[model samples]
Target: MTYQRLAYDDAATPEQMHADCRVVTALLRPAPSIRFEDYPREVVKPTLEISEAAARLATALHLHLD
Candidate 1:
């Protein structure tokens, strides 16, 4: 028996790439100062769409680097 490999293509426009960067950055953000009062300004959180896009981008990166 032979194993089949998954193949995928990851390409995006400049705007889309920016959005994806935001998503991954948001996801990887360090825990803020552990305080209820001293909090950072609120910002729109990244969406599920961006998370998925970032995941796809990471997979593509790993595959390409291999």
Candidate 2:
């Protein structure tokens, strides 16, 4: 599959995409700081929409590169 197609394909159901997005969001989140108070402020926060797009792009790149 082409990169664009792989990244934006409609083959994946909404549930699957949401799950993938959640995984990507978790992976992209910053590690907690040693100080509990600073942890929340320092951590990166990614929206679900952004996570979904990112997950799709990453998958596309990986498959294309292989």
Each prediction's Cα lDDT score?
Answer: 0.75, 0.71
TM of each candidate vs. truth: 0.30, 0.29
In the range 1-66, model 1's lDDT, one tens digit per residue, is 998765966578999999999999989967768885786668788755446667788887884322
Task: Write model 2 residue lDDT over 1-66, tens digit each, in one string.
Answer: 655535564678889999999999988967666986665556568644456667789887884322
Alpha-carbon shift of residue 20 in model 1 (angstroms) = 0.4
Q: What is the C-alpha RMSD of each candidate to the true structure, in Å?
A: 26.3, 25.0
- The list of candidate 2 runs beyond 4 A from truth reads 1-10, 30-66
